[model samples]
Target: MIDTVALPRPYQNYVYAYPHKTAYRPLTPRPAIADLWSGESTSTLSLYLHIPFCEVRCGFCNLFTRVGAPDGLTGRYLDALTRQAEAVRAALGDTEPVRFANAAFGGGTPTFLEAGELTRLCDIAEHVMGADLRAVPLSVEASPSTATADRLGVLAERGTTRLSLGVQSFIDEEARAAVRPQRRADVEAALGRIRDTDIPVLNIDLIYGIDGQTAASWRLSLDAALAWRPEEIYLYPLYVRPLTGLGRNVDPVAAEHDWDEQRLRRYEEGRDHLLAEGYTQVSMRMFRRLDAPPQGPDDYACQTDGMIGLGCGARSYTSGVHYSFDYAVAPREVRAIIDTYTATTDFTRAAYGRVIDGDEAERRYLLQSLLQADGFSVAEYRGLFGRDPRDGFSTELGSLAERGWLDDAGSDRLRLSPRGLAYSDAMGPEFFSPAVRAAMAAYEHR
Candidate 1:
């Protein structure tokens, strides 16, 4: 039940609910390694290892990764990462017999590494971290040019269940417009290779709102992606941010309104098309085939479980704190951070992060859960904190209810209507604590 007349327009901001890393500051005399992870549940943990090297830097890209590493830089980085992993393992030291339920390798492009290097990367995850790659669900991201036979072979041999490829657009002109260079033939070849490997699930990423993209062109891309019968498809709205190649060339104020409307129209079109094609909308961005196997741990919830992130770009999450190495978008800053990461041998304690108080945690819980189509369970929230969400976020909930965002059929659980989901970008930031907002505002984004 949505009030179409009162629907809010999309506010292009951070798509994810959590605070951006720019707000993170270095901790002086960092806390003890053991003390930071003490008494946390290890039964179902998520492991993330970052590979910050990519073959090319796309125009719209702003992740904490850099372009191709020099000849010897990759080796040095792997050596440092292995050392850091060993240290992290030693720090955990028989801590309730740690078990990893899900793991992922994310980066500028994990497949950017050579086949031998890919094997070594898997070894680091399995041997150094003590997570059995074969026993758990593993996911890896790849680009069209790097998804070669040898690389896919290594991934398949190492028990990678999901292979996510960034196929932003099938049209060469549109790809170039987005600063992603790839031919349609290259993308098709990569898709064939991925299917040949029998990787179980293939996720294709597509971006809407690119410059010059139209409804017809968008449908063409969708049809091309659907032909692959991918297990999952992610439709992203292009955002031009400071420091990105696209950000520099465009005038934000001049194009904001038009771009916002275009994105909304395209998002709705894509969502409806996918739903008609037997795909379920998991979130605004994620659409999964009905037949695809479950991807993550069923019993593990990110709000409660601890996550261990290794390498320069990875961010580790504990019960009360989330930390990572320095975050940057500018090429010079990113290179410097990567260089420092490769030179370091210590990886025991957090270097930069923020402390999450009870209020922050509650806000995170609500934002993360409500952004999804399934919403959240009121009873579960009460069990976790001994209070209902309505008790603490009554104002926010009431506002959403007044606008007909809440589902009318359910009283035990709270969920967003289709229109509310479309306005998630605006709603998520509204729940941010004043302190976090101030901290994020104070940090200079490169």
Candidate 2:
């Protein structure tokens, strides 16, 4: 038995990516994009195209997107993406065989673009970037109003394997409370249209915590999503972040006092419900139907592969560095960044990013794997680092074991207990290196 240690708050941060973008700062002398990828393995790369426009900003959202695009802005953005893609493809070099394992279109909402624009976007990915959309698992995010038949048709014809719809709540009242506006009827209609397409997977996004949410209301939303028998589902806890509609309107002290316990209850309820319905939990936020087609190559590990991202908000990751352009949440600042992106002609250098040293990389690998349902193989970590994880992360591992958060059944693999999985948001931050935490702390939130 290990000595007990105090546990941190369960909802402190969402560890979506290691060394969050906030830690990124301007490079002193920008590195040439070509040199960054020089001699790097090009096998199993991921391609991402970001569209940073949405119909209406959600109250609880702080994503780097504006409410709507100005006239001609969409066309200009695509033009810029084409330029960036060309630069990136050239940077990858001609001799090395660059093969993309999967691709994604994410944004304020990719479907917000018109059908013709969507077609052009795919053209850039295929013709300019040399990524065959039909040959890879292409996931795109959509909203109820934007998931029109034409848009869905364009996506289906271009080989979109997955479409994630952001239906925050099936109840209009709850949606309003969460600052999302939509009717259940419209949502169901959108689902019907989505199903009409040959897209193999439909992923519905739902939120569990809101001002007036209760267990009964949470069930309604879950049941409504289940009615469609979506291939996947995501249950996100509502977070009142700075620079968002909810953040501006809600009382912070009250939210802080009330949210954690309430969200935990909702999460457990949702998790158990999905498990009973024959779905498997992929991460803290993702659940997949047992019978859904294989999503991607099982060998693709995000921690080790390189990703090529095009767009102001998309981030590209290489073994030594993760980089992106200027980021902001405020409308004015976001627009300024996008304007700068559209005006950019030189896409050959990385101007803003953080380097991944040996220590940081190990932390990232461990943190990313531990959060998944099937924890990573200890032998794999040992092979990469030339040392056991316990040697480097003994304090953290000990604390987790003391809390009964670790599976003690074996020594060859590192797995989280059910109780530990429930505290993923808390556990993730515990692994943030001191330098990353300091950089993130010093970042100025717009």
On TM-score, the leading prediction is 2
TM-score of candidate 2 on Cα atoms, chains taken together: 0.98
Name the lDDT of candidate 1. 0.86
Per residue, candidate 1 scores C-alpha lDDT tens digits across 1-446 of: 34454555576565463666866789777975677778866777889989999988888898988987986998998998898888877877794888888889999789988999999999999988988888788999999999999999999999999999999999899999999989999999999999999688999999998889999999999999999999999998887878998989987668477778999999999999999999998888899999988764445577668888988998887788888899899999999999999989777777999887788888888888888899989999999888988888888888787776777424878898887777777777777888888988898987
| Prediction RMSDs, each to the true structure | 1.7, 1.5
Q: CA lDDT, every prediction? A: 0.86, 0.91
Q: Report the C-alpha lDDT of model 2 over 1-446, residue by residue, as the tens digit.
A: 33356667788888989989999999879999998899888978999999999999999898889988877999999999999999999999987899888999999899999999999999999999988889889999999999999999999999999999999899899999988989999999999999999999999999988879999999999999999999999999888888898889866666464578899999999999999999998888999999998765534579888899999999999999899998888889999999999999989999899999999999999999999988889999999999999889999888888888888635889989888998899899889999999999999989
Best by lDDT: 2
Q: TM-score, each model?
A: 0.96, 0.98
For residue 118, what is the lDDT in candidate 2?
Answer: 100
User: Residue pairs in steric clash, candidate 2?
Assistant: none
